[model samples]
Target: MQSIERAFDLLELMADAGGEVALSELAETSGLPLPTIHRIMRTLVSSGYARQQPSRRYSLGPRLIRLGETASRSLGSWARPYLAELTEATGETSNMAVLDGDQVVYVAQVPSQHSMRMFTEVGRRVDAHATAVGKAVLADLAADSVAQLLERSGMRAQTERTITSVGAMQDELARIREQGYAVDDGEREVGVRCYAVALPGAPAGAAISISGPEGRMTRMSTDTLVPLMQRLAEKLAAELRTASHGA
Candidate 1:
């Protein structure tokens, strides 16, 4: 059990350092002796979870991709019922997304009964600056962290409404913080608008959103929908916490 914990700690330390680190860096950060760290890393490398670079730096290996994708799919499946409930209540497409690196990846969705409703593919990755879910999650992060993320992923305009400047994004995030939700006003797509709220206690940065055409979304009363979304997010977070505890 101790070895397992140590291995995971090293992996997380490497991830925190942007997926690669020197052996000494892991020792310094983890306070583990060099020999112990080396033994654990060797086990991870042999098990295909980590790789040693030519520079002798350790990096996460490609094998973890399969594990990550499968876990994401499982999470999406588990959240579908919640998203379906949101869609049924709002009469719009509902989606759950998580912050992945500097992008927001859609993990689950329940399309509206309306034939012309908004729809996003489950695995689709969108720039954080352009989506309501992205903004909702980013709003919870520190200003410096948000700036670093934006600097890593350039704020390219997806539509005329997209916030392109860091100052403007900070302002938008401030508004989201004040309002308790975020809105994508034709930002990601020319005619689509979305409303999102951050999940209260997700293991990672996550948000749920309701999206539709500009006309329908604009006509909806945010005063009514935002609170409903917030309640659902809290409920979902509670369930996730329970499950994690059980595990």
Candidate 2:
């Protein structure tokens, strides 16, 4: 158990560094002895989970791709039916996204039947402060973490409606938390509007959203969208819980 914990700690340290670290730095950052870190690194490298660079630095290796693929598949499978239901009901693009640091990455999506629908490919990432799904998930995070993420993300505006001020964003997040979902009124794109709800479970960063043009989205009130989004989130949560139990 201790060995596993130590190994995970080392891997986390490397991940926090955006995937690479020097041997000495890894030991220092992980608070493990150099010899111990070296031994574990060797084991990880041998197993293809970590790689040693030409400069003797360490980074995540090819085996981590297998793990990532597994995770993506699990998330996608869990979200597929829910996204489909949402799309069918709303006739809008429905997407499942998760916070990846300061960005929201689309993990799964169900496209709209309309010919002129929003185009968001799976695996595409967008600024947290500028998107509904991003804000919805961010509102669930700690305030300090939110601040740190905003600082890291630079508060860049994707459109005229995008929130560029940290204070304004904080106020907006507070409202989103109170309302139980987030709304982007053409914030990320000129005519796109979105409504999002955060998923509750192991990966707290997960979120589900419905997006369409402002002409359609603006006609609906938050009271209307919130209930639908909450119900969908609950359904997804229930599915994830069942899957976990089965696993």
Candidate 3:
């Protein structure tokens, strides 16, 4: 049991370090002896759960992909009821997404009962630069890391409102960090608006959002919706953490 705990702790440390870490860095962060960390890492590497990089850093291995993907699928299944609750509360579309690679993927959604509503299909992938969920996920990251991500993704103008410059994206992300939420005002799709809050402990780069047509998702609606989004996101994060720990 102790070994299990230590191994999981080391994995968490690696995840927090962006899926890679040096042995000395892990020792420092985990307060584990160098030898112990070394032994555990060796076990992990041999078991194909960790990979030794050419630079000698330990990176999360490909073997974890199946586990993560499976878990994400399960998460989506359990999140539908919460999303349905959000839709009921807001009378707008509710969505859950996670940052997968350089794109954000919608994992779950609940449509509003209104004749006019928002729709983003589950499993749909969009560049992180043009979506509210994307910005909410990326907002807390270091500016330099965000810059690199944008450079790699190439922030094309999905619509005229899509932030097309690194400087502008940085400014918007800063605003999101300040407000603890992100808004997309027709950036991804014209006449659509969305408000999103990050799920801090839900999953890697997970967020929940409420979206509707601009005529309905106005500033007045934002005042009400953002708060609800935050609360629900918090509840969702707590549930996800509990589930993860049990797993």
Candidate 4:
């Protein structure tokens, strides 16, 4: 058990180092002796979970991407029923999204029954700066990390209401953290509004949202829907924890 823990600890250290690191860096960060880390990293590389770069830096390998994608698919399948419930309860389109790299990708969705409802294409990737689910996921991330991500992604305006400035987006994320939910008031689309909450303990960068027309999705409606999203997010988080441990 101790050995297994050490292996996982080293893997996490690599991930925290942006999925790549020199052996010496891992030794310094993990406080594990060089020989011990060397053996563990050899095991990881032989098992196809890590690869030694030409520079002698080890990086997370391609095999992990397959494992991650499979796990993400399973998680999306497990989350659909709950999203359906949210859609049914609120009469709005419910969505499940995961942050991949710098984009928010919709994985699962339950469209509203209404003819005029919002519908986000599943598998569609959108810049995190212009959407509610993106904001919700970003809200829980450290301010500096968020800043770094936005700096890389370049907050392009999807609509006139989209947050085009880092400072404004930072202020909004602060409010989201305090309020426990995030909102997009026609920021991504001219006529749409969305309410989102992060799924703590779920897949990394996962968030859920409900969206509808601005006219129907009013302030009073948001007050009610936000709590509903919070409740569902907690339930989903618990389910995700169970699934993770089982996996």
Candidate 5:
């Protein structure tokens, strides 16, 4: 059990370090003795759970892709009911997304009942700078960390309103933090608007969003949706916590 815990901890540390790190850096960050970390890393590398790069740094391995995909599916399943409830309440499409490296991956969605509706298929990956859910996830990170991530994933403007400058993104994130939510007004796609809030205490960097046509998703609607979104986020977070403990 101890060995398993140590291995998982190292894997999480590697992910937090942008998916790659040297042994010395891991040791410094984990405060684990060099020999223990070395042994664990060797086991991981041998098991195909980690890869030793040419730079002698360790990175998350491809074998974890299957596990990640399975976990994402499970998370999506757990989120469906909440998203359905959100869509029912707001009469707009709702989605759950998680930050994967520098991108946001949509895991689940409940479309609005309206004939004209927004749809972002599950498993679609989008740049973090152009989506409300992405901003909600990024707003929790440090400024330097956010910059490092954006440097790795270039800020390409998806639409005219998409934030393309790092400074502008920083300002946007600051506003998100201040407002306790993020909004994407025709940033990811023209004529669509989205509002999102981060799931507090989620196992990963997760957020939930509501989206619809610009005409319907107005400031007045925002005053109603934001509070409901926040309440649902809190409820989901609490349920996740309970499930983790029960497990």
Candidate 6:
């Protein structure tokens, strides 16, 4: 048990250092003796779960990707039915995305039924600042974290409606949080509008969105759609919460 705790402490220390740790740094961070850390690091490196850099620092290795893939698969499987229901209700594209760094990566999507629909492939990645789902999740984060993410993302305008100023984006996020949903308003792509609702208790950066062409989505009354969307979101959220508890 003590060995396991030491190993986890070392891993956390390395993660906190942005994925790399020198032997001395690891020992200092974990409060473990140098010899103990060296032995654990040797085992971790030999198992391909950690790698030694040319500078002799250790970092997370490719084995973590397999664990990430497994988690992503579980997330997608749990979200699929909700995505289908969303597509059926709105006749628009429905997507489930999780924030990755400063980007929102589409893990699953239910394509629109219309002949002329906005098509985004699964596994596509978009700037978090440019997408409704991205904003919905970002709104839940702290102001400092949001600022850091924006700085990392570098606001690149994708369309005429994209929010270009940090002040403007902050104001928009405030509104999104107040309304319990986020709107794209043709921000990410010309003639495209998106509406997103964040799922509470989700792993950070998780959100769901429905998107369609502005002509159709903009013309629809929010009074009519908002209630329906909220209901669906509630149901989806409940299911996700239940599944998470069971897991």
lDDT of 1 at 179: 94
What does candidate 3's lDDT look like per residue over 117-149, in tens digits? 988888788999999999999896788878877
- Candidate 5, residues 71-153, lDDT tens digits: the string is 88988888889999999998889999999877899999999999999999899999989999999999988999899888778
Q: In model 2, what are the clashing residue pairs, if there are any?
A: none
Q: Which runs in model 1 stand beyond 4 Å of their true positions?
A: 13-39, 54-57
Better of 1 and 6 by TM-score: 1
Give the distance in Å from residue 243's predicted Cα in candidate 2 to where it truly belongs. Answer: 2.6
Q: Pick the candidate with the highest TM-score.
A: 5
Estimated TM-score per prediction? 0.88, 0.83, 0.74, 0.79, 0.90, 0.79
Lowest-sum lDDT 10-residue window in model 4: 217-226
Off by over 4 Å in 4: 1-42, 51-59, 201-203
Candidate 2 lDDT over 1-247, as tens digits, reads 9888888888867765657889989877788899999999999999998999999999988998777667766898889998898888788999998765457788899999898898798888899999999999889878877886788789998888889988899999999988788888998899998999999764447889999988987886776667887888988887877877888
Write one digit per residue (lDDT tens) for candidate 6, span 1-247. 9888887678766754657769998877677789999999888889888899999999987897687677777777877888898889888888888876567878778898899887888778899888999999889888877886787678899998888777888999999888888899888898899988887766446888888989999886667666666676667667777876887
Q: Which pairs of residues collide in candidate 3?
A: none
Model 4 agreement with the true structure over 1-247: per-residue lDDT tens digits = 8778998888777765667789999999999999999999899899998999999999987888788677667777988998999988888899999887678888889999999998878778899989999999999889988887787789998899999888999999999999999989999899898989999877578899999999888844667788888889999989888866887
lDDT of every predicted structure (CA atoms): 0.90, 0.85, 0.87, 0.87, 0.91, 0.81
Residue pairs with clashing backbones, model 1: none
Whole-structure CA lDDT of model 5: 0.91
Which sequence of candidate numbers ranks them by TM-score, best first? 5, 1, 2, 6, 4, 3
Scored against the true structure, residue 120 in model 5 reaches a CA lDDT of 91
